[model samples]
Target chain A: MIKQFPIQQFLDENGKILNKDIRSQITTELVKNFYQHCVRIRTFDRKAISLQRQGRIGTYAPFEGQEAAQVGSALALQQDDWLFPTYRDHGAAMTFGHSLRNILLFWNGRNEGCIPPEGKKIFPPAIPIATQIPHAAGAAYAEKRKGTKNAAIVYFGDGATSEGDFHEGINFASVMKAPVVLFNQNNGYAISVPINKQMSSQTIAQKALAYDIPGVRIDGNDIFVVYFETLKALERARQGQGPTLIEAVTWRYGAHTTADDPSKYRDQTESQQRRHTMDPLLRIEHFMKNEGMYDEHWINEIEEAAQAEIDLAVQEMEEFPVANPADIFDHVFAEPTWGIQKQKEEYLRLLEVNP
Target chain B: MMNTVIQTKTLTLVQAINEAMDTMLKENEQVILLGEDIGKNGGVFRATDGLQEKYGEDRVLDTPLSEAGFVGAAIGMAVNGFRPVVEIQFLGFIYPAYEQIMTHASRLRMRTMGYYTVPMVIRAPYGAGVRAPEIHCDSTEAIFTHMPGIKVVCPSNPYDAKGLLIAAIEDPDPVLFLEPMRSYRSVRDEVPDGKYIVEIGKGNRLIEGEDVTLISWGAMVPVALKAAEQMKVRGIHCDVLDLRTLYPLDHELIAESVQKTGRTVIVHEAHATGGVGNDIVSIINDTSFLFQKAPVERVTGFDTPVPYFGFEDHYLPTPKRVVHAIEKVMKY
Candidate 1:
């Protein structure tokens, strides 16, 4: 049964196009766009990890190897569509127009990091596992009921498929015909737990069969497949075909977060080997070179530009005004309750007396 | 030259709840209903009877039996500009969805730094005395009140039930509406025909007296009223307060009544260890300690699982127990 859902790929590791049907669809402009975003997010993820190590920011989750999966799926979304991302999917959020400064602020332990830019339908990064799945369904359902073509895309890892919310969310979407795409990045681990320990299912995509929805397993390292498949799924959702689950089979090349040590749970050599042979960036670079679309000067320019942009965001994040302690009580509700009001007053009074 | 009439209907607590949802569904297109068996089945208790027929299946959704799924979905809908009122078949059946409520719905506003608010209500039928089976009669309001960002409202009668349900739906933050199963159809009262909000965080003075303050909410309000009546016969005047909102308890009312009377008895059907009663005690100590005539007395269920229905009567705080507590506080 698992063999039925073999990994689908348009581009192979050697940069050879496996699916000629999409050859006409793939353009030089699309490849460059995917290339720029993949590089931008990878740079950000590595910079975040470095900042965490230097104590410039709090603990950070790195998506160094999963950049293609994040960038491709996010690029497929419409401006009005919703993006529900997990805590580890800031790469996708950034690709979907989330403020880099706010993402940095979030890692720095400030609530201001949670706010998206105005009119961007991006939810705050859901920290709890699989909790955002149902939220995506409901939000998409809202759009559907409003008779709008806007859809939603929710990101999760392979381990999240073990959670009850995953089943519940997909089931609800399937039943209501809610316009949503349950995008799964099979990054092979949930913190320290490996996929084998996570679930017995051979492929996360197969689980969508239970909901009677279309499920596709694809090579997450191939940028073309990830982007085109997600675009197809979003198209289906807009056409009122309900939900589709796309499983991007990929690997995480680093520890789950700065606080973790991946060497404790698994072999570290696999990451080193994958970086040279199976990296998403390398595969895309191979494709660009084979297609004669690669330009060394242009690539250097984008890298320099991405670095400057990220550096400015870092400075802004660091220089933002100190969080007012009163904010803790103020946003608990639209209007503070008497209990919260009293507590806030007492706290402020204590601060004054101490100061 | 105009004639005016304020229409009213005599309804039980559950019927009044239906009317409130009916009114909101008619008034606001954003209002949606979701629960198991809530559509054609009118919910397990019939609180949503005829709502689906009137509003169509899109508005009144009969969801799959997964509480976390629908509740979490409702949270999403609320964030997406929908006012969702979800019905949990029973309060005890809500544990599966507790994570969503605590981690998401309750704190989404604060988590998002006020970028989003969850204007949703969760209605659960709670409490023992109607001989409900295990896990069906747990009155665990304290578990929710311990958290911030969510308001907990429980109504003891038809009038308060109707008004508070409407207010809960209108509230900008998440609200947990606990409907006392025992009091669902136990009594009737004249409910207004249209919309009216019984303000959240305000306690109602059921009866005013000077001897002692009897404080309770939900099904225990009627018990406190009964105790106050019995105390009145013995030349003891009692001030009875029905705290409709449990989370942001009415501090002004609790302090004023406790200070004026100089003695108090708190009643609740929840376990005594960490009940909302403890919070009330803390409030009395904080604000009206100087006026205390005696230590505050509490009449509450024991710190044990609400036993099987055969022993449920023993586990529940009755009017007799409330009267005993008032007497004990008075003697001290």
Candidate 2:
């Protein structure tokens, strides 16, 4: 049983090549671009966490240790393909061309953060787990119906697999041959609920078997495997072969969210230990060095570029205008209903009187 | 001299919904339908019959059992410049997608400073009259009404259903269109063949009377109409106001009706406590309390979980209950 489900990996934690058949696919250009995006998103994630700590932004869900899962998968997508992301997948969103300032504004409790850049097929981060799955299927189905080659990819966590929406999305995509990729980051916990307590299945990939969809497990820490496999899955989707479930076994180096305390449930030391052995960025560095392609000048340039970009986004986000309280009621419907109008008036009146 | 004649055809509430979706799908390439068994099965009640066949599978999509997933996805599609008409199998099953509707679909536009609009409609068969399973027959308009984002629409007849549904699909914001399952195939009227849209947030006057005003929606609208007919024979003429849209209520119409009759009786199929009836009662009290000839009376379903199929008719508000309340208001 274990033989059939052996984890597919292109690179190992020791910076050694594990799968020679796909080694040639890792061109120097591909490695550099992958490294740049992964590093850029990691910097963005750190800045977001700091902003939350300073109370500059509202509560944020950090995706630190899962950078390879986000960066690799996002890098594989064409600009026209659709992306359905979760609250914690902003790292992926940013890599896929979402605005950093708007993302910051979103965490600052500003509604503007939910807006995607012009013409980008990126959805606002869904807070409800597994809800985006069916939406992805529907969109992919729509694309297939329109005779478009574009496919859709949705990101969810380990905990989301238990949701009825997950099963529904995969089943529909499978039967309808919708062009979609069901990407799951097995981060081991949903808030404080461990994977063991959440479900009886050995892995999230196995759940795809029930839907008769192809499932693959991969070393999420290996960026090379992640990028190549995601490309293949997306290609299969565009070919009208239906959906694929790719379980990127990964971990969350930080708390589930800024408001959460992971120390309450698990050992911080264990997380620290994993950081030393399986850090995605370090693993890539090790691979590049072993391949004699590592350059200190290039790495320094990438860091400086990422930091500058993040700094500029922070300035833009900070310079944005203050949010109007009445905005809360304005967009509920295209035309605010009479009830909403009445409520908005009452709220404004209350604000005036109080002021 | 020339003679002109008008032609008409009768259709059920569900038939009106089907016609509305059919018309919209035909006219707009952006408008699409997605829900469990809504395609080949034409919905559990067949409200979406012939849609998939006519529009092809692209416009009318049969989604999986993931209410949250499909509903959320529809929001995504809507934001990405498509008008998605999604169906939640039943009212009670909508809870799983509540967060998405309230958080993302409802707030996306405002959050983005109007950069994005969720032009999506979530259609579900609601209210407790057909007495399905425990979760199958809940009336959850109040829960949605309390949410800041999203428009809640509940139509009472074939005419209103066809028009309101078109309006919902065309609206720029997310809408929750609640269909009364009990009246799906029970009510009928002639629906226009061409494109038409009912203005959301408006009410329609079903009857004009002087003694009292009865305000209701969905299944209770028919009940209120029946009660008004009975009250007329008893020398108590009652005005009936059908609240086509529950969220953005036609308060002007409601207030005007209450002032004219000087007495108000609110009727609904939802449970009494905190239902849409309560909201109407409060509105009347706030705006036209002085016009009241008597305290506003509410005739609503008991504050209990909608009972089993065997006892559903008893639990739901009936024409007799509305008439009783109207008589009491008149006597008072």
Candidate 3:
């Protein structure tokens, strides 16, 4: 049954155009933009992991191998559209205009990191699997009700697809004709559990059939395919055509999180080999080079620019004021509950006694 | 003869919730409903009946069976300026979305340094009298109350349900609104027809007395009231304190009642161990220990899974149990 939705590829692993019909959509400017953002996020992700290792930040979820899936779909979204991201989606959030300094702050256990830049409809990363599905549906539905063209896109992983919220969100969006995109990155494994053990379903894309929505299976490593398909889905949603379930077949070359070790379950050598053949950034570079769209000076400039941006973000994050422990107890509600108030008071007393 | 103007008919608990959602959707552009079977089906319990038709499918959404997905999404929507009211179908089924509620919805404001807030409400039907399956009727209020950033509210009457729900919808913080499925239609009152807001964190004194103070919430409120009426015949004046908001817990009201009565009994339909009743007892012990004339007595369900239909009556904290607890406290 899964074979029926054999991964659809617009561009092959070698960066050769596989689907000539859609090649016209790939302009030189679009290609360059995709490469630039992808490189920018990739660098940011690597820096975050390094910071985590150095005890500068808390545990981090690396999106090393899933760059194409995050970058492509996030880039396709309009500025006004809503983004529901999971803990592993900071790459997508950064690409979608979330502040880098804030992102860094969030990793460092500071409350300031959770805030997105003004006017950016980026939600704080959902730690629980699949919980953002219904939220995205409701938000998109609101946009539709307000007579606006703005849609919403929610990012989740293969593990999240098994959650009930995934089904509920898709079902509601399908029934209500909500303008939202359900983007799933099928990276083979969800934490330690492989996809095969997660569910009986052969493919995540087929789950869309139950909701009676359009489901597309794409080669997530091919940036062109991911970008074009995501844009098409967003367009359909904006046009009042309802929700779309996109299964982006990709891989995660890193651990589930910094707290996890991937070698306990999966083979790491396979991931290293895939880096040369099916890498999203490398594939984009290959396409650009093959199409004569890549200039050595332009490529170098993009790399240098990405590094400088990351450096500034790191500096800004470090220069921010230290976090206050009292901030943790505030804002559970507009007015603190008695329990919270008591707990906060107790915590402060403990701090005072210790100090 | 005095001229009289007739008012609109009173609504049931379910009707009150539906009306609240309808009123909010009509008044605010951001208010939306999302849950399984909420759209064309009007919800599994029909609490959202006619909403999809009146508000259209966009406002009244029927979602897949993805609790975590929708709950987290509602948090996202709330942070992004949408007042999303999520339904969990049953209290027992909400465990999947607990992480989102506890980690994100409850803490977003603090986590974001006040830059964002999750002004959302999660509604679930709870209690054991409904004879629901093992997991369907669990009174999970304690779990939510344990969380720091969210408000937990349980209304015993239709009027309070409607008013508190409206308040919760308008509240700038996330709220957990637990509606008793068994009392959805069994309990009805002359709820105001128009919009009204009930103050959160305030307990209402249902029956003022001098002998013992009975603290209860949700389904147990009715049980406590019944028990108080019964205790009246025995010359035991039982003061019934309905804690509308479980988290904030009108400590002032409880303490005042305890000081006046000199004794207290906490009643709830959830398990006796680690339930909200224990917390109430602990609070009274901590703050009003010197004022208390007797050890706090608790009337609650047994520490076991909500039984099947055959033993539901035994499993639930009945009016008899509440009355017995009141008598025991009075004796103390």
lDDT computed for candidate 3: 0.86
Query: What overall lDDT goes with each candidate model?
Result: 0.94, 0.86, 0.86
lDDT of 2: 0.86
Each prediction's DockQ against the real complex: 0.86, 0.55, 0.52
Q: Is candidate 2 or candidate 3 better by DockQ?
A: 2
After superposition, which runs of candidate 1 have C-alpha atoms over 4 Å from their true positions? Answer: B1-3
DockQ rank, highest first? Answer: 1, 2, 3
The sequence of per-residue lDDT tens digits that candidate 1 reaches over residues A68-131 is: 9999999999999999999889999999999999999999999899999999999999898999
With a 3 Å backbone cut-off (N, CA, C), the pairs that clash in candidate 2 are A111-B111, A111-B112, A112-B111, A112-B112, A135-B73, B11-B188, B11-B189
Query: How far in Å is the alpha carbon of A24 misplaced in model 3?
Result: 4.1
For residues B190-279, could you state the per-residue lDDT of candidate 1 as single tens digits?
998999989988999999999999999999988898889999999999999999999889989999999999999999999999999999
Docking class of 2: medium
Which one is best on lDDT? 1
**Alpha-carbon runs more than 4 Å astray in model 2:** A349-355, B1-7, B88-100, B127-137
Task: Please give, for residues A238-325, the per-residue lDDT of candidate 3 as tens digits.
Answer: 9999999999999999999999999999989989999998899898888988999978899889989998999999999989987677
Error of 1 at B181 (Å): 1.1
Clashing pairs in 1: none
